[model samples]
Target: MREGEKEERTQPFSSPEFAPVKLGGGISPQLIAGRKAGKAEKVHLVIRRLLRQRAIQEGKAFLDLGTDSFYPFFQQYSATQQALQALGDYAYTARWYPSSFGLLQLREEAQRFLRTRFNVHIDMEKELMITAGASQAFDALSRTFQGECFLLPDLAISTIHTIAIANGARPLRIPLHPVSGLVNLQEAARLLEREGRPTIRFLYLNYPHNPTGVCATRAFFEEVVAFAKQFQVLVVHDMDSWYQAHISGISLPNILEIDGAKEVAITLLSFSKEFGLPGLRIALVAGNAEVINALRIHNSEYSVMLPEPCQYAALAALQAFREDEE
Candidate 1:
């Protein structure tokens, strides 16, 4: 190397051999516009794909059970259609909101129906509220009496835990043992005593239990009532499936029938299972006046009053029951 001339500079660079090199300002306007439009089109394609996948995942194929085969012709008369027509005709006639408690006539009918059919007496004005369904009734009750712990049967429907959790309550499972297709009272009592506390605000009991087909005995219900009373715990008895199965010499016992039960129990019943009118969506809650009142207040704050059509339909059903008895 010459003294005046610096050593020749040398540098090494690394790059992929097959990589596409971008030429600045070399892409045409048309190509640039196409690329921009292509980005939006690809995004839309991806969105459509995701939507279709979700639809396929969630869609259910309809099954027709032909329920009319098991019902009397008159009993099968679609009250829902009649209700819709009635509502259509009276849509603008009144701005009336149903009582926060519920429609008086419906509540009376529910009370009278229970008294006559189940031999369970209730006060219509104070002990009952017409709910959209048993689900909403339970939801309101759970919200009203929010507690740290709930005692639920091990074989309970998923909704029991769901509602409890939504209301910030923890559920403790109580295993249900079977004795001749009824909840084993001894086992239940043991579990109840073992899991229960002052913090346990509610003990959930369901008879003609869903999925298990187990009914509770009068003795079992009395025991539960006693336990609840002793502990000052509340009982939410689900009698939704009471009449679905016919058993000789078996009369469903309401928890409230036990002495001192009014201090510790509330019962829920639904027309869905009994009448095969699930879509009609009507149910009742009955119990101590204070508990019912709290439920009603919570219900009013969180739920819409039962639609007029549902109330009317329930009233008609109750009227039919009365006429049949005569």
Candidate 2:
């Protein structure tokens, strides 16, 4: 090798051009730019892939903090086990279509669960539809309301932000209160004022919020309802963790519990966290009949269904919950 070339290679490298950008909350500006260019997967998917590669090489067990560690509680509950055995007995002849609004029995049970738990009443036929999971629910919403502005918490779920971006929707992150971990409505109002309120489409909310475990109060939800109504924006509340036990010993308020909230808000509920049934992929989307109908029609064209087995499993879990209540 040439002497100068050898010296250059041996020298300590110091180049500003090679400096890396710091990632904050896994949502880096560079990452967002890459997603917009269609060059990146969602953050969790990327992490899972890397972890799988490491596990294969090392042959070591690693805990996935993002998911439950055991099989669903249904496997342990005798009632659900009996229910599943009965379902298997008829598996040969049970016919399920490619698409369904949801099983009538599951929806009816889900409605009862909501009323008994949150004291929130919903029409089983018009106000509720089963989804494969919360992610699919978000996917349907992103498509149904593409190209509109979505207001999201700066530190909330990265999946929601990534999905919104990929679907051509404009997502604006608003800062949450540092201590309370709630969205700053004043700041949100300012953004709406500056960006023109009509351009905004959905106000995203979460309780027993992911990653932070912060719960929303009924008063806060009332304020959110008023804000959404005033702005004429639809609210998408991700209540995926609603069924999970909170450390605070407080019963979480369903956004629908607030009067007038039903006119402006719809909520997504998942059984994964509470029942450890992530693989089953059954969830519910409930709220305003108009918005629910829009999602239903959009999904019909694409054809998505929560399989009968999953519907039945969810029903069994709800029944167990009801029995416990009794």
Candidate 3:
């Protein structure tokens, strides 16, 4: 027997100084054994296999649609190559917890831009929060509010349903009047009175609505806001498509502009449709301080801070727009 082998054989197994040999890197043998025999590996394998199947199915559907040749018209003006180049230079994770709301300069810029463009005033520090996107802002608001019943337009985006469901809320779809292409406020009021249990807590409004391209008039928005205030129900405004259309004379009034709106309404805005930077994932929420704070808290708990690079890029884009206007 070799001298080392003899010493190893004689060594006490009880010695605290002696540690088990690491299999790969610093991974212990027991962990390696567990990984080889664990249900976690099987679960991950199943998920990966299912994802592959979904991808194949989606590819087949795309092929059927002939999407390869038919490029859908994008609303944003930037070209694909330009967008890709911009993204290649973007670095998103240089800050801590995303300033608990967002970067101050970006928020200030957003406030100023929205105010100047839409004629709606927002306090950057008190009433606005920078979010991952309007999608996340809506989600955070819904989660924090914890309502039982939600009223939304029939033509609302799928995200409304998803956020409602995730927040333990039941959704009641109110039809958009075909003639006006706006939420039938009378019908919505009736539905709110009829389907609303004591737990019914809120209603959702969308303008320049999705799937159906209909914009609401100022009078209509005022009426809706009044109804929500009367019923003591919160209102969530999905303004994702606000920038998609240009209305004549009346500078696109946000729900925030309606009388008593700030008392009961939260407005969501996205950078995706407006700037054609969907992947950049910048969005904001403007509303009453209580509501905004609730969302901020929810965000701090459930979401990582928005990447600083995304905020900086969004700032740059906003500055470009301002310069263009000048």
Candidate 4:
């Protein structure tokens, strides 16, 4: 080497190399770990095997009611159909994309809906958003508010199951009461106490509850709000089936009605269930102005905003809902 010339550095080896050994039929055991699938993946294989065995014995005529999802075959209300028809020409030309929060007209209608229906006042521009659906809304939120851990109900939609996982977040499970099928609020409160509340950044509670069909009382929501404020945890309340409560002659209270709920809670109200328009996929979200703004930003970058015509269709669903009441 010449003086003042720098030597080319070589990466140092930590251990001696082993001689290459041939495996059976040139197959690498490390490359194919046929035995290394996780329990969740293995469960699907187990179900397939059980299904095949059952088919052999039962001749493929059996019914399985294991999953929560059910076929929705209800008739479409006329107002909804007519509204989509009204959008026939505009849908093609209504192409100017909307705010990441959602369309202005839909948000305005939703603002009125909240005033008349829930008596909650929100600034449509800052505090409310029109989103694709519950899953998409939650996906954006789970990404927006990600922290040390997210607390999810053990019995929740599959979307909940995967949202935290997709974000590489550690999710802690909150179980519901086995007998009443209501959220085990006491257990949750205890966990919050134990986990230093702020460490668990969120508590996702859905009512007019999915899967279990159990609803929570306004008193419970008040308790949740107080607890959330105390612990510095954000409360996510899903009111996707709020309309069903009214249809069933049951009064479902909104958490936002409770005092100070705005500080700690956000509510998701979905039109897909009420309007029977899952394919169109629309929902409303309202909460703290800061959080809503964060959601709006994340949605603009990472998610699809609700289209203009679908926003109009959501307006029609509201019209039909009122007509049905009359």
Candidate 5:
């Protein structure tokens, strides 16, 4: 080690879900090891590979957070279980190919669910799309984006960072204000033009946001839409608000509902939270018809459509649970 060279220190600590932590600012073990190994990029991927391997091999249960899928009496409490069960014979002869976007009924229910719950209306045919899961949707979006640089929050699910890096998009990490816990849109946008690039990529936002529960208001979303149009940037809004318990005086608004949002933004939605169906991998990305068309082509060729049974399971989920238990 060189005497004057500074070593990056990684501090890893466990915290409750919805609680903010300062891990991204601190170096991660993988990053530090990657630098020390002298094969930085390769080493980073290797460590991530090993971590995922360990998670699968050990069968560690994530009970405190993101554990909505865990229920002791799985079928016993599930209203959708019967619906899933009824398809025992039908599964044998179900259609092999699901519509590229999604099934009509599922999209219909999803649209109604959003409209009734949050006042966000998603058009089933042209606007909404069903994907395997939120992660896969983000993975595709990171690559589908036409620009070279995107923004990442200082703190978020680690996978979000990996998706951007894996797709060759530079992530401009924006720090959350200590008091507000909000990403400064102005500061983040400023960094986009810092490099004087001709085209700036999308700003990916997750609200009722992951790791941090901070949410944006309708008015703020309007500002974001204006900001995107002003700078000619695309906004990727991940409203993965599946696990939200209703908070008094707070409302969840889809970015699409804001006028001009469809011009510049695409929102991601998931049925994972309510249905306890994460493994089933049923989620939707809706809004921005052009991006949807682009994604439709990319997804049809590269993405594996979920098995036909999963679609039925998704329908059962949307039809079954009226309460947000998660």
Candidate 6:
């Protein structure tokens, strides 16, 4: 109110941060509407109502079981508690931005986790990079390689289709084999052939697959590797649910386990569903150093870096999981 004193300016309503992200060719209105429709499907509504009714009858809270979240079980783990304490001690370091690739210790522990649990080995510095989450990594990958077409499981999570559409790529859904519930390679190949295989750039796969819960066999992976090599298509294998296989005493095959897989495939690992740390937003992309480097560079400009605290917490959780295995 004083003369010569400037008024306190309010932040503008519109800023660069609020601007719409132009993913690749740019996200279209149809893609946005499809994303919304996918999220508000009737089945989701029914499940939410059932959960509420169950919670009311039981006189207790219920988490969204549809998400396959394990936070309730995760919090009770001794390792989780220890990790939380350790994370609290180092939380102040969050004042700084962690390496776009993520923290070294976290990546190292991730390397060890893969080696010990899956019998797969990767170079921490070259073959792996930490992502904010599996979806973020997938989005970046899709944007980086906006191929003419993407081959996806007919029943894959909606995000896969949404990302494909947002990246200006045509999504061609392929059927699964009736007996094994694994992707039907013959059908996929036929579809690709029909679509003109040269336009096919990415084939997305998931195992201990979400919703359907199918696990891939080693032979199937061998077939997939051969198929990718033959077709010259890059395979993006999302093994985010790897822990589900461990819990079920099923030894699921990592695509990287297949010989020559790295030449045509990249695997994504997530701790969110496994460790009940979805809020932490940390995951890893492994295999194919060139692909990893591409994602690293793309993310540097267009992606938000994971904080140091999340990295420390992820490291602590990885250590705890390892100790429990021992």
**After best superposition, candidate 3 residue 141: deviation in angstroms?**
1.9
TM-score of each: 0.69, 0.78, 0.71, 0.74, 0.73, 0.85
Error of 1 at 48 (Å): 28
Per-residue lDDT over 1-326 for candidate 4, one digit per residue giving the tens place of the 0 to 100 score: 22111221122222233345576555444222322212243354356445644554554432323221111223455645655564664587366875567766778878888877888999998889888888887778767875777777877765565565555455677788888676777887787667765366467888877767787888888888987887778888988864444436777888898988999888989866655566568889998788788888988887576777777777776766656666
Point out where model 2 deviates above 4 Å.
Answer: 1-66, 69-90, 242-249
Report the number of the highest-TM-score candidate.
6
Q: State residue 57's C-alpha deviation in candidate 5, in Å.
A: 15
Judged by TM-score relative to the true structure, which candidate is superior, 3 or 6? 6
The residue-by-residue lDDT of candidate 1 on 1-326, one tens digit each, is 21211211121122122234377745444333434433432443344344434444466222223222223432444533344345555555246666656678888888887777667788887887878888887777677775777777766665666666666666676666644555454665666567654377588888777756676667777888777766677888888854422335466677777776777888888777565567667888888889888888887786557767666766766666576456
TM-score ranking from best candidate downward: 6, 2, 4, 5, 3, 1
Misplaced by over 4 Å in model 1 are 1-95, 180-198, 244-250
Estimate, for each residue in 1-326, the C-alpha lDDT of model 2 and write its tens digit. Answer: 21123333344332122235455545455445525533232455556656644654575544455553243344575544544554565454248563467878888988997788788899988899898898888878878875477888877776777677766677777889887889888888888888876466578888877767788889899999999888888898888864634334568888999998899999889877666567568789899998899889877878876667767777776776677557
**What tens digits encode model 6's per-residue C-alpha lDDT throughout 1-326?**
22111221222322222237677766566567546534533355455556655554666655665463443676587555666676787889988777888888888988988888778889988899999999898788778885787888877887777776767677788898999999999999888788777566589999878778887888999999999988888899998765534355777779998889989999988877777677678888999888999999988987569888878888888888788778
Residues 119-220 of candidate 3 have per-residue lDDT tens digits of 778888789988888777766766677667778777666566655665666678788787998888788778767864445546887776765667777898
- lDDT order, best first, reads 6, 2, 4, 3, 5, 1
What's model 5's TM-score? 0.73
* Candidate 6 residue pairs in clash (backbone atoms < 3 Å): none
Query: Which parts of model 5 are misplaced by more than 4 Å?
Result: 1-62, 71-90, 93-95, 243-250, 322-326
Best by lDDT: 6
Higher-lDDT candidate of 2 and 6: 6
How does candidate 3 score on lDDT? 0.67
Residue pairs with clashing backbones, model 5:
132-281
